[model samples]
Structure formats: C-alpha cells, structure tokens
Target: MSRVRIAAEIAGAAVLLVAAIGIGAFLREQRTEPQSPAAAPLAESLAAPTQRPQPNCAVLGQVTPVPVPPLATVDLANGKKSITSAEGGYTVIVPTAWLVQPGIIEGTAWFGQTRITSYDPKTLPRPGPEAPGILPPSFGISLDLQLWWNPKGEALDQFAQHMLIGPDQLAVLPGGVVSVGGKQAYRTTIQDQRQYQPATGPVITTRQTRIVWIVPTDRNDRVLVAYATPGESDLFPEVEKIVGAIVLTTPASPTLPVIHQRDEILGRWLYDKSGAPIAGRRAEAKLLTYGETVAAFGGGTGLPRIDRDPDELFWLVAVTGPDLPQGRGGPGGTSPPTAWIMYEAPATNDRYEGAGTRFASAGTWPADFDALPDRCR
Candidate 1:
C-alpha cells in the first residue's frame, strides 16, 4: 500500500454552473403559498432563540479573553480583496495579491508571498455536477485553518498535552496567547521533518516550522490555525496579521424533525483517516430501515474491505447500534454522530482503522448497498 499524507487530502466536487432560467425554475419549485397572519406569529415565536448565560472562554480552554473589536474596525483599509463565506460561516480580509478558490472541504487562497487555507467541518463541499479539474496554487509558505471539536470541554493545556505527534514533532511555545476573530486562542510551534525520494539519489530530510493557533467557536468546536514555513523561515508575524482580520460567522444550527434512531444513519458520510478527509475516494455508509431493525454497511474505495461471508462482504464494527457515539465529524458528517467507529484493515491487524465523518445530506444517496460492496469489497 502506498503511504499518503493525510494533510494532502483536499478534494472538492465542481460547482454546477446553471443558467438564470434554471435558477428561476429552482426558486419557483421552492416557493410555497403564504401562511395566514394568525399563524405567522406562532411560527416566528417558535424560531426565536432562547437566551443563556455566556460561558467563560478561559474555562472553556480558551487562553486569551481580550475584548474583540468590530470586524469592520479592523485595519483592512489596505486590503483590496475580501472573502465572505455564508457556508463557512466566516469572513476575512486578504490582500488583493492573493488568489482565492473556495471549496467545501477546504478553501484555498494564494497570497503573492503566502498561501492561506481554511477548513471547517460545518462548511462542506457543495456537490457539483462533476469534479472541477482545478489545480491548487503553490506557495512557499502555507497557513492552514481546520476545525477541532471539544465536546468534553477539555482544558487547553490538557488538550494540548494529549495532542499526538502525528507526522511531526511539536514544541510548546512560551508565547502567552493570541487572538483571532475576537476570540481567545493558544499557540504552539512545531518542527517537523519530512523525507522525499529523489529520482536518482537518496532521501532528503527537510525541516519546517509550523506555528499553530487554537481558536474556539460557539459550538463546542474550535478552529486550528497554523502557519507553516520553510527552513529557518519566520512568517508567523505576517501570517498572524491576516488571521487577526478574520471575523467568523456563527454556524447555523441544524433543524430537523424528530428523527428515528435507525433513520439517523441515512445521510452521506465522508470517510476519513484520523480526522482528515481521505483523498480521491468517497466513502458512504448506508442503512436499510427494516421495520424496526436498521442494518448497517460501510463501503468506499482506497481502503481495505472486510469480508466475513462469501455472499456479502461489508466493513463494519458492532456498537450498541441504537445509540451512536458522540464526537466530531468531517466533511460528510456535519453534526456529531450518535456513535462512530473506525474501519480497520485486516492486513495490519488493527494498525489502520478508517473513521467516517458525517457530512450534510446530498439527498441523492442510493437506497441499495450492493453497489458499495462491488467497489469496496
């Protein structure tokens, strides 16, 4: 099996381009008759938000709690470009010199001298008619923003302590705290060594520096911001400036009618390895609701398949079934799933277990699980 870097996994389906008339048709289909005035108040009242005391940022594992200035007040006067994402639920100012391409899994913006990439689970790739044949721009320096969920509300230091050395080594920094999007956040500096084989020579070792920021959000989630630079290169100060100008919009709370335990597993799920979207392959889990019993099966390419029987082979693990585990999901699984388990390959025994992240429903999932076995098994 070829070893692939999880960090390199960024795939987005191409956005569908439609004519004005097509958009009109879509709008018309969604139009419904107006409700009576007598019922309008009840509907409005039901949608009103309930008030609760604000939670302390520090207690929530946020390091800095400085007052945040209005997003418009930021010194973005020199910026010639602005990126606003209704789906990403955030707005930030970038230099006009940067090149921007927004995707559902991750958004890439290339600054003349730097590249900034932002990723959040709440923002997923909008399903396009097909995959766009677009190539990502290159930059010597990269800034990465990813989403992290802290449902248990672990302390910043404790959570940081539990961080894995995945593909890199991290050294905790003495820097007090950093602020982003008017929220308190912590920072860490990491040094990583990467090896690549040359066509005609031995492997080369390269050292890089990554400065990361952990910024919390409204939900029990946080955005991880990191600035990566080449050997001996210092770009945190410049990158921090771009990050500071960010203003994250609150994520929309999902509203759905009460769901049955079995039907909750119906939506699309993106297969992930250790929290990162798997490259190239699109994995989906399907559940057939049979009376009161929900049968589950997992299928996807680019990973090993579990064959238990000859007639049918599925990748699965037995959980309590009804009550799914609560944890963060990736592109496919938007909200925390009821329960989740990793997909384990039989070869390594238990070395490589692929986890599935819940994503928004595309409304086009196949009812049959047979196709999955064909591609996966």
Candidate 2:
C-alpha cells in the first residue's frame, strides 16, 4: 500500500488494485441471444441506463439513495488521465498529476496526491507493474478501485450487511444500494493505517479514510471504486466529484465475444473471524461457477425455441476447498475461477427468473464469517 504525497507540504492517499480478466469471457458466452422481436424489446430495454429508480435492495439494512450523474460528465477537460480495469470492468478519471501504477487488484493505481507542486527526490522506487513501490515526496492517504471477489456468494446487499462496521470505518456499507458511475452500486468507506516511503526517507505510517463503491459488473463479479483521503472528511467532496465522473460500460467487459485474459482466482480469503477485517488469510473455501443452458419454454422447439439474452444469469457454488480442484484449476493456475464463494448452502438467486431457486445443496462457510479472518472480531 503506497501513500499519497505530491509535494513537501501536501499529503495524499494509498495505491490499490485487483486481479485481471477471464471470467469476463465466460460471462459473455453464457448470455441468451435474442431470436425474435419480443426478446429484442427486452434486450433493447436494458440499454446502458443513465438513471433508474431505487431497487428493493435491503441486504445492507437500508438504502441510502444517492443520485448518479451522467457518464458524459467524464471527459478530456476534467482529467489528466483515465484508467480502465479489465478486472473491475469500469473507467475512472483522476487528476493529471497523479502517477498511475499497474496493480493486479486495482488494475491501475495512483499516488494519492491531489495536486503536484514540488517534491524532494529520494531513493525509493516508484510503484510499477509488479510492485506497490513508493515514490518521492509522498506518503499518507491511499486510493484504490478493486473488484471485490465475493467469498460468501451472497447478493451485494447481504454481503454488505455481514461486512458492515458501525460507521466512518471500513465496511461502512450502510448504503448497500447506491447509484453512481451511471450504474447501481454499493458504497462503503474505511479508515485504516498504512505505510509508505519517500525516495530516500525511512518508511512512514499514517491513517486515512477510504470511500469504496462496490459496483456489480456481471453475475458473481463487482468492481470497487475507492478514494482515500488524508483526513476523515477533508477530501470527501473532492473525491465525490472524482467518482461522480465515472461511467460504467454495459456488460462491463473491456472486450467482447472473446476475452484474451483468464479470470483466475488470484487469491481467496477465509471470510471468517471478526474485529479488524482479516486480509490475505488462507482461503478455507472454494468457489465454483455453475451455469446451465437455460432452454426457452414455449410452444416452439429446436432452433426457434432458443432464447438470446445478452445478460448472463449465473451463480457460484462452494466446492471442495483448499485447492483449485474444479476442472483443471490449480493454485494460481490459469484455469481457476474468480467469482463468489457460496457462503451458505441452499442459497437462491432470482436472476434466472423462471429458472427457479438455486440450491447450494451442502457446504460450510465462515460466519462467524468476516473478511478479517486474521484478526479477532
């Protein structure tokens, strides 16, 4: 985690990232294609909507209605640079002075400096494609946008409830249902400690509040838009304006038909324990993505009966744990899946409509479940 500091006096935030693409392709291929005009109406109706009424999402206990600005708000005039995450499936604009670093999780990360004036150069390495490297004249706040891999395979609202802390801290998902970036999203803010260094200076530690927006990309996938500030509330307004400029693409994939990258389960966490959220904990459970060829139910048969719904209605199933045993998936192998961790058995999803409820059949999940399995609740 790298902190933000652009000049001698000003402080900034931290750098964040996440895993990359593959499930994106799997998700696209599973869609139902429209064969008739009736289905076309349904598909066309779901066009990249800029606004929609609040949904019945109560999993987080309540809905904090937040208005989303138009995607058109993001443009060359408002940005120095723009970053898109194949893993997260979205794009965000940041200040022109911010340094962009490649992060496996955050896709691309940045030095959290809001503005750059002058800096003291030191000996520290700048963050790059392979590391959370820190640069000179900086330290303190952090910002990241990652697609949170849901371990419990629950709806976003439900997951928010389980992960919620009181308020003004990490897991501040009181607003599980928010609309931003031209898409429906989940909002949370976390204040935590992190360390960063100047070019030639010793490592420094600081506390900052990170506001996160968990936006669902597709079935079993979500992207987190996070901005950390030097103080609790100093940068909220500024960060809000930055995030408000986001515009989510429909289907949320950078590429279509075929995704060249594999959506590997870069890592898994045992969403167990309590207290401070546990990170980098060994995963005790495994997630399996199961999708079926939903046959169209009508009088016609054969070719005429198949349906086409670009939207994929899929869910993850908790499978044998400790290893990527499903198919040819391996530990860090190219074949592993990066999706949900079916937290509870016999869970149901309504995305399939008449497809009926999905049953996990049987499995054990942490819950006594929490993201911070390493720390005690």
Candidate 3:
C-alpha cells in the first residue's frame, strides 16, 4: 500500500477505537448510577390529603350531642356561691355579682358566654381571632393577652409582634412599667383608636385603651390585658381600681419546668402543657446561648431556634420529621421523600403566657446549666 493510504487507514482505526471506548464508558455509567427509591407511596402517606372526607349529606341531620359540665350558681345579691362539681377540663371563675350569659358570642368561633358582674364580659372580646367573648372594660389596667392555643414556642414572639404591635391601635411605650397585684407589669397606652378588620370587615373597635404587659416572675407566660373606653384621656385611676381588684390565682399547668437555665436550652424534653416531647421523636439539639442567631432547618415549619436577643422573651427548640432531611415518618415508617422545617427564637415575652416572669421579657439569661429531661417531674 502507498505510505499516504496506510497512514489514512491507521488514523481511521484510531478514531473507531476512541468512539467504541466512549460508548462503552457511557454504558457502564448508566449501569452504575444508583436509582432513587420510589418515593410516591411514602409521599402520599406523609402528605395530608388535600380534600377532607365529606359527611354523608343524604343522611338526615341529627341533633348535636352536648357534653354537660357541672354548673355552679352564685347569688350576687346575697354573695352566695357554690361549686357542685368541676366537670370541664378548664375552670371558670366569676365574680359574686356578675350575670352570666349562656351561648356563643356573635362572630365567635366557639361557644361560650359573657359573664357580667361589676365588669362586663360582653364588653371584652378576645384580643385575637382565636379568642371569643367581650373584652374587659377600660379599667386603665390592661393585659396583653398573648394567644397561642396550639402554636410552637418559637413562633410565640412573632405572633405577638404581628398581632398586638401591628394593630397600630396599641404601641409599646418607652419605659412604661408598673406593678399589678404584686406582679411586675409593663404598661403602655393606646395612642389612637384601632380597628381590626376581619374577613367580613371590621368586627371590633377600641379607643383610648391601655395594655398592661404582665410578665410572671418565673414562668414562660405573659398576659396582655387591654383596658379601653370611648374616651382617650388618661384612664390610669380607673385602671388602678380595676387592676387592684383583679384576683389572679395561677392555674396549674400540665408542663412544669424541669430545667431552668439562663438563656440556654439543651437536650430533649417533653412540653408540659401538651405532654408532647420537647424534642420531637425525630429531633436533634445543640446548645445555643442567649443572643445567638440560629438558622432554622427544614422548610415552612415555623420552628425557630431560640436566638440571643435582649428583646427576645422566650426561647424554645423543637424538631420533627419534616424538620429532618429524611422527612417525617408515619406509623408504618412512611414519610415524604422531601420535607422542610425552620426554627425561630422570639424576642418577646408574649410567646408563652401563664408562666412568664417580670424579667422574662427583659431578656435575662438563666444562671445555671443543667439539661435534665429525666427530671420532668
């Protein structure tokens, strides 16, 4: 063969060999790559159904069954009261002379009555949508009733800021502090009449109201009682009389403090109120001091890692399946293939009520460091 022709043939052979090796490598790669597990069934089980089961409309409507609790009657005229039996999980207290109205208040989510004594429950609607009934009258002594019926601890701060402070009707005044019934309270006056617009439009209005933020001395609770009247001038005198007359007997909480550290929480523990583990069955924990900003993991789950901010009133940490990378598992070990969670630490004492201290909202750190989950006595 001529030299040029031989060289051309050799080059052609080299090209074919390269192409063959490339194809072989591609095939090997395809075989070696791992296949992700089929996440459909897992996802379906983990995800809440978009549609809820509808009741059988064809069936005739049945009368609603009511659970009866023991009712106690009080004769205000003679100042006589009797408790037959405490049946409901919650205890209801009324003044001797107050008239109790039975039934749900209009535009309320639940059924309850307004008890009118010297004070009118009808006048006091719940501070937020979650609560219903008449708000307390303007006695000048107001309570910032922080509501968190089923909220995570980390979200309590944000809930307070957005709901109470955002109203513009109430403003946190500078250096407003007082003592109510021996409880150190922070008082702030409402500068203007604020209106909250519900889905149906403005359902409630307030004017010249004062909010007293009472932080407990040693608990994770804060109470915001708002006192307002039609007029705007200083209502401190009436507030003093009303506040002085308030008899607050601390109710027993299901969750008691197992460990109290100065501004740092560690380990896994169960929450007292809900009897659920503070460390969700699938949670992890790290020691965070007061004022350190911790990033929340997972997505959409408003779980907050307590950060160190002097203004932060509450700090709690919790985790769940969605907070983990593997997603939340179900009873049968099923979980979503993908999940997201986040943790937040709020700077306001309004996160937890009924157990907050006067210094709680002041951002005071705990002094000792003891993580005792077993001590949940």
**Would you estimate the TM-scores of all the predictions?**
0.40, 0.35, 0.32
lDDT of 1 by residue, 315-371 (tens): 221221111223333555454323223221111011111222222212222234324
What tens-digit string does per-residue lDDT give for candidate 2 at 84-186? 5433345667665554443312232221112211121232345432123322114433344433335336676665554421122333435556777776777
**Candidate 3 lDDT tens digits, 1-377:** 11111121123223333434543343234223422345333323333321222222121112232333423455545553322212211223333543433211212111111212333434543354421212333422222122112223322233234333222344544435566556655554434444556787555664444443332322242232323232232544543555444344432222112132322232222122344432222222222322222211211112111101212222333322222233223554554343212233322222221111111111112222124121111
Rank by TM-score, descending? Answer: 1, 2, 3
Weakest lDDT window of 10 consecutive positions for candidate 1: 302-311
Give the distance in Å from residue 242's predicted Cα in candidate 2 to where it truly belongs. 1.4
* TM-score of model 2 (CA atoms): 0.35
Q: Which run of 10 residues does model 2 get worst, by summed lDDT? A: 11-20
TM-score of decoy 3: 0.32
User: What's the CA error at residue 66 for candidate 2, in Å?
Assistant: 38
Error at 115, model 1, angstroms? 7.5
- Give candidate 2's whole-model lDDT: 0.33
Report how far residue 65 has shifted in candidate 1, in Å: 37
Task: Return the TM-score for candidate 1, rounded to 2 decimals.
Answer: 0.40
